[model samples]
Target: MGTKESDGVDPRVLRTRRDVVDAATELFVTEGWSVVTHAEVARRAGYSKATVYAHWPTRLDLMRASIGKICDEADHPEPTGDLRADLVRGLVDFAEDLAGGHLDRVLGGLLERSGSDPVVDELRRRLYEAGTRSLEGVLRSHLPEVDVEPSLALLVGGVLTRGAFQGRPATEEFVADLVDRVLASTGRGEEG
Candidate 1:
């Protein structure tokens, strides 16, 4: 048989979920998110809206899952301890992700909903955490004693809102230079 859904969803649930998200991403890129509806996503994915919503309860759920899927597909390499080099690589990856445009749409839609929707707010926090973990780990390695937790929010949050709001592309060189400023501002000596 195929996947079944109950108290716990099945593995094929994941596949079906991917179909829905792929459909959503394509629609967001091609038609703009405000114009895309659950019915449109269902048609694109060749599934019922009930099937889509069974796996993704809300638009926020679908958006978060789409971003997570994109990140997974990117399969970005982990940083290898060189602060500047790692930051440049990570920022390029992020810029590529952002410039793909679906992510920007997803972020924008969710942000609007999140102003009054607690579920959207939590979904955004989870998405941000997922995207920032590798960068945060690398930053802490470079400045172990620095309160880098706040930096996690600042760096990624700033990049997303600023880039999206300003319609500015995030360049690797820009981020690399920003890394230098961060190191200097932190007054950190050699982390080795």
Candidate 2:
């Protein structure tokens, strides 16, 4: 007999996990963290609550799995070695994500409950790292080692403020200008 691909685990179990996690992630992205419950996820995934509870055991567990999936699926533009262009592209993409409402919902929930628990704190950190991994790479390549974090903060913070805080569109021109300002302040504008 042929062995199963999932290390001898039944395919049904794997399917259940995928379905449950996918449902949880969709709920998180659309409705915020507070709405992701075992009951809701079970209904959305067409599985019983017992099945979800068996796999996840808690709301935090579901959030962790969903955030992990989000990080794993994060997509960013390819860096072409042009610092200004790359920064502009990255920021623009980030703005779009915020505008799409998915990021804002998840971020709003995380920020609303920041520091209430160690697990929540870890999830927040993971989400930030995932969201900024691309921009961090670009900054690290061109800026001084000491400046990467601040520059990343400035770039990402600017977009977040403009799009999520101010409730305005972070236009391409705005992002490009923001990138130019940061790069100029760091003495790396256009040249590196």
Residue 53's lDDT in candidate 2: 96
lDDT of 1 by residue, 1-192 (tens): 122322376668667776888998777655665766778889989999888877777776666666556555544577877876776677667767777745666566666777687766876676666666788878888778878876656556556665677777777666665566666667742432
User: Which numbered prediction scores highest in lDDT against the true structure?
Assistant: 2
Candidate 2 residue-wise lDDT, 54-158, digit = tens: 999999899988988888788977899999999999888889989984898988888888889988888899999999999999888876555588888899999
- Minimum summed lDDT over a 10-residue window in model 2 is located at 1-10
Q: How many backbone collisions does model 1 have? A: 0
Task: Give the local distance difference test score of model 2.
Answer: 0.88
Clashing pairs in 2: none
RMSD of 2: 3.4
